[model samples]
Target: MNNMKNMKVPSGGAASTLAKLGIIGGIGLYAAANSLYNVEGGHRAIVFNRLVGVKDKVYPEGTHFVIPWFERPVIYDVRARPHLVESTSGSRDLQMVKNWTSSPYSSFAWPATYSLSDPWREL
Candidate 1:
């Protein structure tokens, strides 16, 4: 215990330098981790910048990068989905008429009109 007390600890500059390095390293690590994003299959991504707003470019499936906090990714499922509609009413002859419709719906073409900040707003 007496021998351990004899060892001098870093007093000022060295300690401060280590602290600075640690903070910078932590910030860098966080930025690195946040800068990357992935878009899965059957999905598409759009970039939204804090300053300029949603960009015109769309990212395809796989990995992509953006400025950490300044930009964000909005993902949308573009795969075709089945939709069904059915209606029953009386026709001009007073006879009951039934109608059924099935369609494939997808949002692949609607990204251009979407706004990241206000999802309901049009671009």
Candidate 2:
């Protein structure tokens, strides 16, 4: 993933030197190199391709745990949401007060897989 573009220098001599030197700016350059020595020039930007390693996420506090890499991919989110509510009920002989809720929002962690095919089940 190398992208090299021809950059125009202010002078013909400078442009020729840069091309003769074969200077590539990292992994991102494009176009035919040394094609033009435009004194009145344009702008050029370089882009690079790279591989980034995944970060290891932390589990909940106060609990000892072991996470196997084979069992999980490292992209689960572990945020928490809360809900609270109040309610009431009554009968002929007695009365009761109740507090209840079903939270509309939730967050939890679940393991993901690198390979998703079922082998034994295929047969």
Candidate 3:
């Protein structure tokens, strides 16, 4: 009891250790959130860099990791997308052009997923 009473406890050690652990935990969480990206179902992801534009590779639906503060991911829906194309007729005749757009992934071939609307001459 006398030795215990005479002993001097070290102050601020536990508090400092807890503070360091809290800071490390916060940094880890931030890094994990920034480094991980989720590509949802029926969707695809493209990796984009801050220094460069869009990356060439397309990631499928899954969880992917990227370098924090260096690269980011852009998600696009690969499902059948709807787009309306408007064309003006040269003559005074009012004609309706019914164009059926196919899906990107289909029997009809396409070079890439991204493309411009082809001029439909057959009205």
Q: Judging by TM-score against the true structure, name the best candidate.
A: 1
Q: Which stretches of candidate 1 lie over 4 Å from their true place?
A: 1-11, 87-101, 105-123
The candidates, ranked best first by lDDT, are: 1, 3, 2
Alpha carbon RMSD to native, model 3: 10.2
Q: Which lDDT tens digits does candidate 3 get at residues 1-123?
A: 899989999888889999999999999999988999898987777776777656667788889999898887777765654444455444457665555554545433323444211111121
Better of 1 and 2 by lDDT: 1
Judge candidate 3 against the unseen true structure and give its global Cα lDDT, from 0 to 1. 0.69
Residues 4-114 of candidate 1 have per-residue lDDT tens digits of 999899767888889999999999999999999999998888888988887877788999999999998998886666666789999999999999877655344334323
lDDT string for model 2 (62-104, tens) is 3222232212222223233355556777767797857587563
- Give the lDDT of residue 12 in candidate 3: 82
Error of 1 at 69 (Å): 0.8
Enumerate clash totals for all models, in the order shown.
Answer: 0, 6, 0
Cα lDDT for residue 11, model 2? 73
Report, for every candidate in turn, its global Cα lDDT versus the true structure. 0.79, 0.34, 0.69
TM-score of each: 0.66, 0.21, 0.54
